[model samples]
Target: MSSFDAEALERAAKAARELESSKHVKAAVELSKREQNVKVREYDARKAEASADAEKAKAAQIQIAAEERRKTIAFERKAKEELMSRQQQMERQRMREQDQLSRQREQDMLEAKKQADMERDARRLQMEQQIQEERLEGARRRAEAERANIRARAMAEAEGRILEQRKNEDIHARDIQRRSEAKAAELRGAIQEAFSQLSSTLGSYIKDSTALRNTVFVGTALAVGVYGVREGSRVIGRVVERRLLTPALVRETSRTAGTFGLRQRMKRALGMLPAEEVGLDGIVLEDKLSSRIVETASATTNTRRNGAPFRHMLFYGPPGTGKTMVAKRLARTSGLDYAVMSGGDIGPLGKDGVTELHKLLDWGETSKRGLLLFIDEADAFLSSRSRSAMSEDHRNALNALLYRTGEASRSLMLVLATNRPGDLDAAVTDRVDDAVLFGLPDAAGREALVRVYFEKFVVRAGEDAPRRLMGLLPAARASKIEIGEGFTDEYFAELAARTAGFSGRAISKLMLGVQGAVYGRGEPTLTLEIMEDVVQRKLAEFDERRRLAKTDYTDSASEAVTGTAADAAARRSSA
Candidate 1:
């Protein structure tokens, strides 16, 4: 065992130790490897879990990204669709605007055409109216020219006719004048022969009783013959000339003519005469006469500063009153030239009437002698427009008369006689300076007038004859007698008393009627029987006229009263 064994043991022991240490190290290593392996396994497990989670997160991210992409695409698509819709709406709006513009243009063109057509129609109508007016004006002008030609022809024809009539009248007048002159010359020769014979007879008578008686007788006879011849010649000359030969003869003729003419003209113009002119003795205007008129005229004349004396008078009265006779007397007393005019002569007063009146007035004014302008029935010219129912022409004539009367400044007298004073206008009355109111004659006036009439008709009887006749008949009966010679103052007085309320005109008519009755009986002188018969007839006529006038007056009064009563009743009712 020794040393070798010890060595081997040691070796073995060492080997054993080594072997144990190897086992321990191997076990430790194995344990350490197991622990490490466990740690690694845990790490691997954690890693694996982490890796799974990471993978999940990545998957979620991918899903989210895809959703975002889808959303973006959807948004882009909507925007594009909206843009297209806007474009379509804009295009529709443009189309509507264009359509409205076209309609407006068409309406404007139609209105312009209508206005042009109306203007053309108006112009055409105006032209037609102008042409019609021109034609009417031309027609009127032609008518006026034709009327002027007709008037000229009528004037020429009228003048020719007037000239022919004048020529005929002139020839007749000249022939009458020549015949008168020849007769006058013959009368002168006869007068001269008679004078020569008278001178010889006177020479033969010279001294001695017997011879003286013979010579005286012869000379006386010769003287008578000469006187007779001269008287005969004058009578013949007057008849030939149709006028009195000398101034004295002419004056006598004029006096006689005036009485007859005045009576007739006055009766015709005024329808009446004064009692004096009719030969009835009565006072038409008692006491006063023409005093008022004379005074008024005198006053007017006195007021005149210069020119000739004014003696014109106008007498206006009712029918049967004296006007013309008074004028004639006035003309005779005043020594004025007298001319008579009838109102009827002025009726045809165109230019001719006016000219004649002017000429007559001028002649009167310019004459050396005082002229009397006597106009009968003056109311015919001076009548009121309302009363006369005058035409415009008549009124114009009256105006002319008024002008001449008012402006007259000459020594001419005018006497205007009228029956109707009421019919004269105020202007006419004012222009006249004097007016005489002539009324019906009273008993005394009528008697005086009758006497005047008797003097002209009956030859005057001797004083003894009138008394003798008065005794033979009753006083009233004898007075009514229409003596051929004019009545005496006493005879007219008795007749005037019997005929009460009789106008001067009626009295004169009665006288004429009495004369007619006497003449019918073939009696030379008027008798009482004739007078009575005539008076009875006239009285009956007068009574009838009065009755009719009274009846008319009564009826008119009744009507007026009834009208007044009815008017009063109506007025009361209205109130």
Candidate 2:
């Protein structure tokens, strides 16, 4: 009962209290853990519900976007189909318009062709009627001429009979009155003697009476005698003239005859004679000559500080190289008087003939303020004197030419054209102020010449006919062809080409042949086929001439070679 017992009771009670507290803490902790678990389960359920709703909304949005895309695609496809249909309609409309235009054009062309045919028929009928009328008129005129000639012959016969009867009566009367007629007979004899003396003196002064008469004659006579002399005697005379005449003769003749001398006569005849005025275009001469001529002409026209006349020029070339044409053009462009003559005509003058030549020179020097003398074939008159047998007449003629060439006057200009420059006298060559050599044309020139001919035919055929024919011509030729304003250029280049190796004279013959063809065809439009045929014929003629020339050349060459060989053999034998 004591202090120890009370201490044990207290310890036991304390132990009980401590045990209860520990149990209560354990219970509270367990309760709190259970509440936390319940809160976690509730949060999981709410998260599951939110996830399902979000999934459903997302599916709805996907379906709406798909529907919108499908609608847009359908609209685009409709628009493309509508555009294609509109394009097809427009194409059909354009095609229909083109067909209508094409038909209209065809109709117009047909109508035009019909009109052209009608016009052509009308023109043909008119031409035929005119030709018929002309033939009838010509026949009537020829009949009238025959009747007139018959009447003239009858009148002449009657007059002749009357004259014969009167002559017989006069003879009978003279016998009866012999004493009275004695004085008249003596006077007549004296007159006859004087006339005979005068004739003899004139004969001595003139080498040939025939030459003097021919020189004085003009127009047809001059042309025929100078240019158309085919007789042997005339040819011989021409050769002799080339060897004998002096250049001074022209001056002397002019002085002796005064104003009425040979020079004046020639000038008058040239002026009065009817000439065809032809217009030339695109006439390009050989380069050397063309350049020289153009330069000379330009210089002449140009004004200088020191006043001086233009320098003169000479043209040297093979025959038919257009030297004469250049000279003529120079004179025409410069507004100067032109006097043309042949070397053969100038060189053949005898002492008596000199007077006429001199007169011509004087007229050129005095009357023509600006005069140009064109001497064609000048080499014939001014041949090399070194190999020539000297004659008094020949020496004098050479001296005269030298004097004229050296002495330049404001009024006088000389232009000499020669084919054989080697034959020209040394003095004459030295005196020439300017010299231009003409050679064969180049390829370009030939092409141009062909074009010129085509153009010429077109112009001659006229509008409608030429137009129709032009379509048929070669495109190459048609593109290049150009017609001159007038007839000057004509078809000379083509004619010249056709007459290759031919002289100017021969070329003229070829042209005449072409004209003959045209006439034969009754002046119809010269179609391409017709032109080609004409060209072929011309070529055939040219070939024949070439063959003849070749034959002659070969023969001459063989003869020369044979002669040389013989001479060499003879020399060897002598050695």
Q: Write candidate 1's Cα lDDT for 1-575 as tens digits.
A: 53546777888899778867674878877889999999999999999999999999999999999999998899889888888888888888888777778877887886686567667777878887888788888888888888888888888888888888687988878898999999988998888888788767656554346889876899999999999999999988745333212221011111223356666465545434322221212224466765643444345444333454464455765566667666655554444556677665676665556656765665555445456677888787778767646767677767777788763446566777876655667666554555566666778777765665444333232221221232343222222233544334555667778776566777778766765565566554775545556776788787887677542112332233234434543544475
Model 2 regions lying over 4 Å from their true place: 1-280, 303-310, 387-391, 461-512, 527-529, 544-575
- The lDDT per prediction is 0.62, 0.60
Among these predicted structures, which one has the highest TM-score?
2
Cα error, residue 99 of model 1, in Å, equals 99
Q: Which 10 consecutive residues of model 1 have the lowest summed lDDT?
A: 244-253
Candidate 1 segments exceeding 4 Å error: 1-285, 290-312, 386-388, 458-494, 545-575
Score candidate 1 by lDDT.
0.62
Q: Name the 10 consecutive residues with the lowest summed lDDT in model 2.
A: 474-483
Tens digit per residue, CA lDDT, model 2, 1-575: 64568888999999878867785867876888988888788888878888888898888889888989998898899898889888988898889889888988897887697579768988998999899989989988998999899999999999999889787997878786996689789999999999999999788769787777766675668668766666767878744443333244232211223334565455444543223222233565656556767767656545121235434456775566678776766665555556677777654665544555555565565533366778787876777778556455666766776666554456667788876665666667555666666665554565455455444444433322221232343222222223223334444455455545554333444444544455466443344445555666677777886777552112332233334434543544475
Per-model TM values vs. the true structure: 0.40, 0.42
